[model samples]
Every structure is written in C-alpha cells, then in structure tokens.
Target chain A: MTEEPKPRRLTPKGRATRDRIIEAATELIARNGVAGTGIEDVRAAAGVSGSQLYHYFDSKQALIRAVITRQADSVLHPDQPRVTALDSFDALRAWADAAIERQRENGCRGDCTLGSLAGELSVSDEESRTDLATGFLRWKDLILDGLRAMRDRGGLRADADLDELALSLLTALQGGVLLSQTMLHVRPLEAAMNASLAYVHSFATTAGR
Target chain B: MTEEPKPRRLTPKGRATRDRIIEAATELIARNGVAGTGIEDVRAAAGVSGSQLYHYFDSKQALIRAVITRQADSVLHPDQPRVTALDSFDALRAWADAAIERQRENGCRGDCTLGSLAGELSVSDEESRTDLATGFLRWKDLILDGLRAMRDRGGLRADADLDELALSLLTALQGGVLLSQTMLHVRPLEAAMNASLAYVHSFATTAGR
Candidate 1:
C-alpha cells in the first residue's frame, strides 16, 4: 500500500486530532496487535470522523510507522533520564535500574512497544521492518555515544569493542524485556541486564574509576 | 474459546493428519503473524478438509499452542547437537555458533518461531502466553542444566549463580535473534551471544581450562 506523506505542519486543532488517533492506535495495537486492530477501531477509539481519520494517516502502514516513531521516542527519551548519554558505570546502572523498575511497576504485562512491533512486523512487512531496524539502530547509537564518551574519558579500556558493547547491551535489554513480559516476572530482565553490565564493567579501567 | 482436549492416543494416520496441520500452521505463522494466519489458511495449506482440521484442533488457540510446542522442540532439541548439555565453554560457543549460523543460512528472514508467537500472543492470549512461558522455561532449563554441570565439574566457580547465567544467555539469544531478524544482519546476534558467552566465561575456574 502507498503511504501518503503526512503534512509537515498542522494547525493546533489538527495536531490534537492526529495525536488522538496515534494514541488510540498505539493502545489498540498494544492490546490487540496490528493485525487485530482495524482502521475502524482506531477511528472509533479516536472519535474522529471518517474523513478526519484519513486526513492524518493515509494508510494503516503510515499509522503503524507513526506508532513506531512514538514508541522509539518514549523509550529513547524517557522523562526520568535527565542525561541522554550514559557516560559512567553509575549512569549505566541507573539506566538498567530504571528499566527493571518500570517493569515491576507495570506488573510486566506490556512488552516494549518497539520490540513488540519488531516481533510482529519484522518478518512479514519489509517497510515496517526497516523502520523497526532504524529504531533499534538509533537506540544502539544512543548507547554507543555513551560508550564513546566513556572511552574518551579513559574509563573504558582502549581495546574494548565499543560497537559490540553497545549492541550487546541493547540486545540484552530487548531480550530481557521480552522474556519478562512473557513470564510476567522481572528476573529475566534483571539477570540479562546485570550480566551485560558486568561484561561492560570487565573492560573498565580501575584507575579511571 | 474452549479448547478441546487433544486425544491421548492417535493411530498413525490420525497422528499424520495432526502433524500435517501443525506443520502448515507453523509455516503460515512464520510468514504472517498469529493474528494474520487463520484456520482456513492452515487447512488449505495442509490439504485437509474442513472437519478434518477441526477433528485435530478445536480452536485456533489450540493449534497455536501446538505450534509453540513444535517450535520449542525444534529450537531446544535440534538434530545437530549430539550432547544437549552445554557443560563447557566450547560447548556453549558451539551452541551460540549454531544459532548464528542458522540465521546466516536463512538470510535472516524468519524470526524465531517461538519468539514470534510470544511477541504476538503473550499480551493478548493468556493460555498461549502460558505455553510460551513454559517453552522459554524449558529452554532456560537446558542452559541451566549445562551451567549446573559446569559447576559440578569445577569448570565454573561454585559461587556463580547458575539461574542468572542461564537466563542471561537465553535473553541474549532471544534479543539477538530478534534484532538480527529485524535488521537483516548477523552482527547483533554475534555481539549479544559473544558478550553472553564472555559473561559465562568469567566464572570459569583457573584450573578448569
């Protein structure tokens, strides 16, 4: 399906309508999955008129992409994290702790929105799969930036593979969260993050610490 | 939906029909998510008549559970591994290598079948979610058994927590495969498994090697 270009600018009212549609779609998809959630369901949940729903999202793919973007933003730029870069072990621990804490608070019912989308869309949808991959890369880059900062500061060993380290941590988080969601427990996520954090710590220069 | 109890005993012909249905459903779900694949698709793919499909699987959820079990068996008990227990570091590396090699061979098109099902059903279907969780636990147990053997053989430190190690490895795997499938690359899986293996290695006794 061809995805119509979303308008770059919108009136305040238009923006509100569009946000409502995305919010509803996100919730529905979270519960019922993308295939289970229909366009009519989104329109009904958003309470937007038929033409209004089409005005913002030309196709379901476009709406799903919007959801993916929103999920990436929420995950990558959470409000609690004042700093974007994880420059130190303490910062990294805090990042891991925050994730585990969130899962506990939520009772581990919902999986990561981005990860859930990836699991559902990656194999079946090429365009959506690329978007999911981009989201993962951006997430990996955020961690990479921190690893780079740590290396520059002499906190990490010079020989440590920063790219591998970043990818490993992201992988651990994604895997950990998925298990936690499925099992309705936080142990898997905690263990995965703890092990990954230990791996990063292994490369830490004691003098820098 | 009520699930009909699977008959305890089936004639060879009856078993073949059931297996055929499951095989078809597995392929369909692999290409399209659980929500996307329907009973009709499975029946058509299996070349079974309408009542024949129902005779085996009372509901879609029942069929999905069978798929989950089959995937778990295929993943956890592949034909290539002679020894199921990963007692040594080399064995662990080989296990990880086999998974990476499979992804490479497949060109990273299919996500792990059990994982894909988990991603789709873990949130929406309680019964299927439980089955998935059981499958993950069984997989984790295989790793745990290896870790326990390693500790007993004095290859791993006695102080090491085997549960955490096993969970971490499994988490890394699920996460790594998910990323590899989504990104259509093997690097993420490599990084994740490498880091996990290294973590396991950290506990190896000096004398064990």
Candidate 2:
C-alpha cells in the first residue's frame, strides 16, 4: 500500500470538481432559496466554466439533490463512541447541549435546506419528496438508536416508549428553532430542550433506582 | 332611528361571494403553497368568474394575505370564555383538549400560516413578512393573555415567565405539527401536547391533582 493509504484513484480530480459544484450550490440555495437559486449563480460561485459544471452534475436539480445528501451528514455528523455509552443523565444533557450549540453558531439563519425541503413538500412530487424524506428518516433513526441503547442500559423507564418519545423530542426542538429564528431569541430552543429532557427523565425513572 | 341590531345590507350576496373566494383560496394555499396557488384555480373552485374574483381581492397575493388573516381566526375562533376558568386544573386541561382536538382534525395538515410564513422566510421580503409577523404577534398575544390569567388566579406558577413559555408552547406545537405531517402520523403531536400539559400542571404544582 502507498503511504497515503492508497486513495481510490477513480478520477480524484473529477470528485474534487463535483465537491466544488455542491459547495457553491449549498451557499446559493441557503441565501436565495430553492426557487431563487439558479444554476448560473452556482456556476459562478464554483469558479468553474459552464462545461466543467455540466461535467460534474447534469442539472440544477441534480446539484441540489447532491447538496441535500451532503446535508444529511450534518444531521448526524460528529456522532461519537460515547453515543452508545449514554447510561446517565449527565450524558444526555451533554448530548442536548451539543445539539443546541450546533444550531446556535448559525443563529439559525440562511440555513434553509430543511426549510426548503419543507417549503417544497406539497409542491415537489416523488423524487424530491424522497430526498427530503430520507434526511428526516435518518435523523429520526440516529436518535432512536441512541435512546434504545440508553433504555437497555438500565438508565431509562423499563416501559419507556422510545420511538414515540424520540419523535416528540425532535419535533419540539424543530418548532423551538423556528421560534428562535423568528424572535431572534434562543430561549425558545432552550425551553423546548429542557422540557424534552424532563419528559425523557420522567420515563427513564427506574421504579427504585 | 334605524332598528338597532339590523344587519346592514352589506352586499349580503356579494358578501357571501367574497367569503367563498377567501375560503377556497385559504385551502389551496395551505395545501398547494403560496406560489403554487393560482387565481384562476381559486375562481374555478369558488364558482366565481374572473371579474368577480378581482372584485373582492385585487390579486392572488391579496387573496393569499386574506387567507392568512382567516387562518388566525381558525385558531382563536369562537373566542374562549374570555379566559378558561382558571379556578381548577380541569379548566387548563379543557383548553389543552380544545387545542389538541383542533390540531387533530387535520393533524397539522394544510396551511399553517405561521409555518407557511416561516417556510417562505428565505425569499419573502418586507411586506409579506410583515403580514406574517402581524398574524404571529396576534396569536402569541392571545396565548399570553390566557396564560397570564392562570398566573393571576393562583392556578399557575405565579412567577412563571408567561410570555416566553407561551412562545415556547406555541412553537413546540407547531414543530410537532410539522413533524406529525412529515411522519404521516399524529403521535408526535400527541406526545408533545401531553408533555405540554404536564408542564402546565407542574407549574400549578397541585401537580396533576
């Protein structure tokens, strides 16, 4: 094996070009919206000639679809080994803190990938909807898995309904984010997160532990 | 003197036509989204010809703005008993029940004007954003006023931060609604609402008594 761990040499330059296209697309979409973000704008941002862009992604929709896939990584990015070690209250609190901090850095502005997906919900049919749906499902799964592990570790209510509760927790945070963005105050998010943690703790109470 | 309580001949026929135009527009905008809705489509649905549609609302944007105003009424409609009798826990429960039941009818389906507003936040400019902001401020006022009574009546945490909490509660519910609609199920809403009630009871500290 070469010193660089033998990178997959299947057109590394093409892969880099594709990434540039997506990075440009992400920035444009966030500011101008799915309706307003045009392919020409993305081309200019990527600093690539028109033909170079077409060489990477076939169309604007294709570029957006790729950008969306890239967004899924943000949803569960930085997932850690401690993910499975959530056998304590402090651990859960830390997880909530990490999540809140992630959104806080942006003050939740111009990051409308999720918003765009929602805005397009009724307008976009099968393929686009699936693209949005996949992002949500993955977010749900990651949290559900984390909660399930906590439940098995004797840190949760023996009868805690992890699935329903996880759904509630995520939804509350989402609404809280909207409020935070609108009011330009982060307290709504903090409040929602606290309430959710309380709910989880209520169910996580072992009969005598 | 004119007979008191005599309903003005306020274009009774024209009034009915005007109402129909708005009603159809509301449903379409909620389900199809603002940009996706067409004036011609609203006219066909309302059974009002082109000039008739224009007679009531100047344009599709005007009609959509009217639909948004109507949506506010749908939430605060029939106006509660000035205040839900805060003398007992049951009263708060009743209010919660009313809200949950209302949300359940469509389970957060169709035009959440606030969600619709936020959905378009990236691209919507000053005027339309102001229209949406006005509706939200009014909605929050209704809830804040209602919660304040609970505090005054000694039925809630006397020191409870009513405004912040109200904003949080509303935001959480909307978030839950968005999630429920996304999941194609209402469990998330039910859980979030239940947790809200529990929070309310905790504030009262007769604690679900």
Candidate 3:
C-alpha cells in the first residue's frame, strides 16, 4: 500500500492542496467507511478539481494509503518519547492511561486506526493488509523496546520472553479498545490493560517482586 | 438490530426463499463489507429477482441485521451445552482450545464476525452497534455463567470477580482473533487465551488448581 514518493519539489500552494485532500479524505473515510466514501465525495469535500486530485493521488487506493499512514501516526502519538523510556512498571501504566484517555476524549468512538483499517481491508485487500500490518509492527516494536529496557535495567526477569509478552500486551490493548468503543464504556479497556500489566509485573526481578 | 419477530406463519417455499436470501447476504457481506456488498450483489448471488430480494429485505440495513443475527448464532455455538458444564480450569482450557481450533481450521481468515461488523458499522450506524454489542453480551454472559459455576463449586476463590474476569477473557479473545487473522498466525491468539486462562487458574482451589 506504499505510494510512490511525492514529487521532489512543490510550490507552497501545491503542498497545501495535497495536505487538504488528505485531511478531507481522512475525515470522510473515518465518518463513512472506505467503501462508503467515494472519490467524488472526497473531491467535493477537499474542494479540489478532478485533475488536481488525480495529480496528487492516482487512485482511491493511493489516497487511502496516505490516510492509513496519517492515522497510524496519530495512534502512536501517545507512545512518543516515553516509548523509548518505558523502563519501569509505572511507565507502562501511564502509557495505558494515555491510550484510555484518548479514547474517552473521542467519546470512545472511531476505534483504533490500524484496527479499523485491518478489520475492513485485511481480508479482501492484500496490499492494505500489509500496510496495516506494518503499522501494527511499528507499535509492537516500540513496546518491545520498552520491555527490553526493563530487562536491561534488571526490572524484568532475565528469562522473560520479551517478544511474546509485548505481543500479548498489544493484543490486550487492541481488544480492550475495541470493547470500550463498542460498549461506550471505559472499564473493559481498563481491565484488559490491567490484566496485561499484571502479566508483565509477574516477571519482575526478585527484589521488585 | 433485532427484527420484529419474523412473520409467525410462512409457507415452506416462503421459508426457503428467506433462508436463501440470508445465506447469500451473509456470504457476500462476509467477503465484502456491509457497505461494499450491494443489494444487487446479493440478488445476483442468490439468483433472486429484485422483487424477491425486496420482498425479504426492505433495505440493505435490514438484510445486514439478519446477517448479524446469523453471525451471532455461529459465534455463540461453542457456548451451548458446554458452557453450563464448564466448572473446572480444564474445561476453560478446552473452551479456549476449541476457539483456536476453529480459527486454525478456517486458516485464520474470516476473523470474528461480530468484531468485523462492529469495526465497520459501530461508529456510523447506531442500530448495528447495538446489535453487535448485544451479541458480545450474550457471549460474555455465557462465560460469566461458567465462572459462576466454578465459583459455586469451590473451584474459584470466594473473592473472585466473575464479571470482570469474564469480560477480560472475552476481550482477550477478540483481540487475539483479530491479530491472528491479520498476521495469519495463531500465536497472538494463543498467547492472549493463555494469559486469560492463567488468570482464571490463579483463582482455582488447591486440588482443582
């Protein structure tokens, strides 16, 4: 789902138009799903003529790929700086809180970006699936990095399988966010995160334990 | 999301036609999302005239409601006789195994029906969200029932919170199934289920544990 790199240079006006199209398409697709939002709707919403829209994005798929990248960036915002600094248990709890807070701020709607994309496109679209998977891996790698930090700092047990634990923690977060979005309640997300955190804490160093 | 109960009376041919429409719609929607699969597509797939399609379902949403019901039924199949009988840790493990086995048999492709529906329709369509939430609740209640059974049998600690545990387990399964389907691997699902199972076992009585 990767698009060709943008042109080497653009006028300020040209850059603004491209950003406008992506922002409009993102909101439209988020409100109406990928299938429900058509190129015409995007062109109208972005206020760009057909020729201009085609100049930036060759097809609807290319536009969607840009949206996915933008959404992924938004989803990973909470983990910035701290993702590389998550050496303590409390840091993990704070990370979870940030995720839950973001969902609550959005009224527990829209769901996760990568998750929504994966659910809609993963089964039918191979290229989109790969793109969504890449987004997930980026998130996963950040968490893995945190766990590795904990291990190096003697916060986690030496034998703990960081890869498996990291994936499990991510699974919990995804599941929790989904339930929270569906039920319009925060408890499910809290419970899922707590459960995963508890699992991570189980591998604490003897002194920490 | 629930239809006014189907007409109390129908001829054999009438019942057959309704069933055919539902089957075709379910397959089509499962392959292409609710928005992607048009009524005309269902009509063609089922070999029904436009009038026949309209006779059974007044609108696409109505047909989707029926498909949601059908998918809910499939998802709840494992909870039938076995849920009432799940009074031990081993029984819970068996339940997890069954879920994983089904996904494995499907090559981890389809993912969770209710989850997919919720992801696509929950935000944009309130009726469908309510329907999918109801389906999730039914599954949660069965797990709650089994946890209650274990509690009453002294298989669980007196202080165990069955409701939270049950929701957490369901959350884990939903997340696991989603990751497994996207990665085309079963480890994420297995890990999530294992973590939940371990939580359940943590409450087990001495001999039962």
Candidate 4:
C-alpha cells in the first residue's frame, strides 16, 4: 500500500531535518554547483539519508527552489533597509566598498549568489530562473529607490537615468566579480567600482551642467 | 583482451565527428551548463552513438577544453581581418558598436564562450580552468597591444592605464551581456556599451591631456 503523505506543513522535528538538508545543500551548491550536487550528497552531508531527503524535498527542483528562495531573503533583503536610509554619495560608495570587501573575503569567487546559481543551471530552467530573476530585480528596485530618494533630495541630477544607472551598477559589479575571481586579485573590482562611482557621480554633479 | 587501437590519430571522418561533438557540446553547455550536460546528450545531438563520441575525446573534460578553445578563437580572433590593427578613437567606437550589435542580435542570452566555462566550472577543474585563463590573458594581451598602439600614435592618452581599461572593457562587456540576458532586453547592453565607449573615448581625446 502507498504510504500516506505527511501534512502539507511540517512538524517541528520534520522542519529541523529539512533545515539541515538545505544548510548542507548551500555549501555543496556553492562549491560543486546545484546540478552537480545530488540529493544523496546533500542528505549524506546533512547526516541524513536517501529516505530523509526524499521525504523533505520530494524532488531536486523543490530543494533548489527552496535554496534559491532562502538565499534571496537572506542576501537580497538584508541590506534593503539601508537603501531608504542612504541619501548621500558617501553612503553609496561605502556600500560599494563593503560589497567589494565581502567579496574579497570570499576570494572574490562568488559575490552574486543568484549569478552563481544562474551560471550553473539552464537560464530557461523556469523554477530556478524565476528565483534568480526575482532576486536581481529586487536588488535593482532597492538601488533605484535610493537613487530616486537622492534625486528628490537634490543630491542627484533631475535628468539622471535611474534605470540605466541601476543596470550599469549591476553589470559592473558582476563584471568586477568575474574579473577579480579570474585574476585571483581585487584590482579589477576596484577599478570597476572607481570608474562606476565616477560615472554615476558625473551625473549627480550640478556643475557638469 | 584489449583491442588494438586503429591508428587512433583521428582520420578526416573521425575529425569531422569530433568537431561535431564539440560544437554540439558547446551549445548544450551554454544552454544547460557544463555540469548539467552529459556525453549522452552531446552524442544524441551530434547524431552519433556513445561509442562514436568516445572514439574522439577520452572524457567530457577533454571535450570541454576543445569547446573553450573554439570559443576563444571565435571571440578574440574573429575571422574578419584585424579591425584592431587600425588605432583611432573612432575606430574603437565603431568596433564597440559592432560588438554591441552582435549582442543585440542574440538577445544577449548566451554566455561568453570563455567566461561561461570559467565561471561555472570549479577552479580545481584545473585543465579547463588553465585553458580558460590562458585564453583570457591572451585576449587581454591583444587588447593591451591595441591600446598601447593607440597611445603611441597619439590617439589615446599617453599615460592611460591600458591594463585597467582593457580589463574594465572586457568585464563591462560580459556584465552588460549578463544583464541583457537576464532581463531579456537590449537597453542594459546599449547603456553599458555607450558608457564604456564614452569613457574610453574621453580618455583617448587630446583634451584629456
């Protein structure tokens, strides 16, 4: 006879086991890649087994989506509160510096969590792609809000291309991460940030008019 | 008993088969990722069975290197003779414009042939990583040469940091492509190219001196 399914919501003990699986999955995914790391590997790393993993995730896709969603909340939302609070160029530059420093700590190998995930999976892998897309857009939205606030405060050009600048910042950040990782140095990251800061500030300065 | 290898240096037919396999594998790797793709998929796509696929490359890693090598040649050494041979601000902008056009045509979804492999594969995938690293350095060296030439000819700034500029240009291009692909649009790529072209040209102008 088919075993009855557990309740849609997990019991406390069941929840703990699921959390362990994802925790293990995160490290493995960061190193070995999402597709490269199998459920068995995740379960074993979490000190669980095949039965335990299947019970929690039901499928690999479910586990992947959960991992991405978890990363989204933890990473994309943590610094979000600061966006509204940033009203000056120094604050934005400081944020960039902090981002580069964190990436340096990671050996500049993996800055964009969503970017790493997107790299390993099919861009059309709808389940995972959606999560990555959401995370990126969320990041863009927050940064745009900060720029808009600055604009309102008369700290930015009224004609500043918010959307374009936001995208440029993202592209430069991603590019910097790649270059840093590839060269095993932070110089590229620094150069990109310096140039980007200059470019953005070029628009912010009223004297440029 | 081990069967005697039939002059396994790859006959023309075998070479053709090998090229087909590499081409198919590269496309699949770009779409599904190197980790997610398999020999079976490459063979099927190339219309060859498993044995035929194995006859050329001893392993998947070998095939990956070949693909990376191919992409390196395609990206850094396009068939059209040496537009980079000419050194002028207008020439640089024209080349940048052409590159942007290429991205626009593809909708910017495809990853850089060298870069996708580098970012997705592990650093410990030494053989392929080394192949990629060599390719990037070589391409950068070519760009560096071009910039140095421009400087010598008084087309660019005498004291311009050519290395930084070339690295930034490459990084920005990749980043711009990544953004365009994620959003399924062209505005990001256009802005990145435009800004980069402007930045580079500003440095190249005599007024900057």
Provide chain B TM-scores across all predictions: 0.93, 0.80, 0.88, 0.81
lDDT of each: 0.84, 0.64, 0.78, 0.68
Quality of candidate 3's docking, in CAPRI categories? medium
lDDT of 3 by residue, A1-209 (tens): 45544745988999899889988988876677787789999999999999999999999988888777777666456546555456578888888888788788888876436676666777677777777777777777878888998898888999998887887788888778877777888877877887778778878898655
**Model 4: CA > 4 A from native:** A1-20, A47-56, A76-87, A110-112, A207-209, B1-17, B47-52, B78-86, B110-112, B207-209
Candidate order by DockQ, decreasing, is 1, 3, 4, 2
lDDT of 2 by residue, B61-172 (tens): 6776676567655665657662334345565566656656666786556645565455555233434445555666677677777777767766677777776666656765
The count of backbone overlaps in candidate 1 is: 0
DockQ of each: 0.75, 0.36, 0.59, 0.41
Per candidate, native contacts kept equal 0.75, 0.36, 0.48, 0.30
Q: Write the per-residue lDDT of candidate 1 for residues A1-209, one digit (tens) a residue.
A: 13535646898888899989999999998777787789999999999998998988888988998888777767556575733768889999999998899899999875446777788888778888888888888888989999999999899999999999999998888888888988999999999898889889899998656
- 10 residues in a row with least lDDT, candidate 4 chain A: A1-10
Quote model 2's iRMS: 2.6
Per-model TM-score versus the true fold: 0.94, 0.80, 0.89, 0.83
lDDT string, candidate 4, B1-209, tens digits = 02222335877887788779888988887777787688899999999988887777778877787787777666545563444443556665666677677767886666545555555663335466567666667667766777888888787877778887777666666666655666667776666666555566657656433
Output the better candidate (1/4) by DockQ.
1
Worst 10 residues of 2 chain B by lDDT: B1-10
Q: Candidate 1 on B71-190: residue-level lDDT in tens?
A: 777755557573386888989988899889989999987554666677777877788888889889988998899899889989999999899999999988888888898888999999
Q: Which stretches of candidate 1 lie over 4 Å from their true place?
A: A1-4, A76-78, B1-4, B75-78
- C-alpha lDDT (0 to 100) for residue B156 of candidate 4: 82
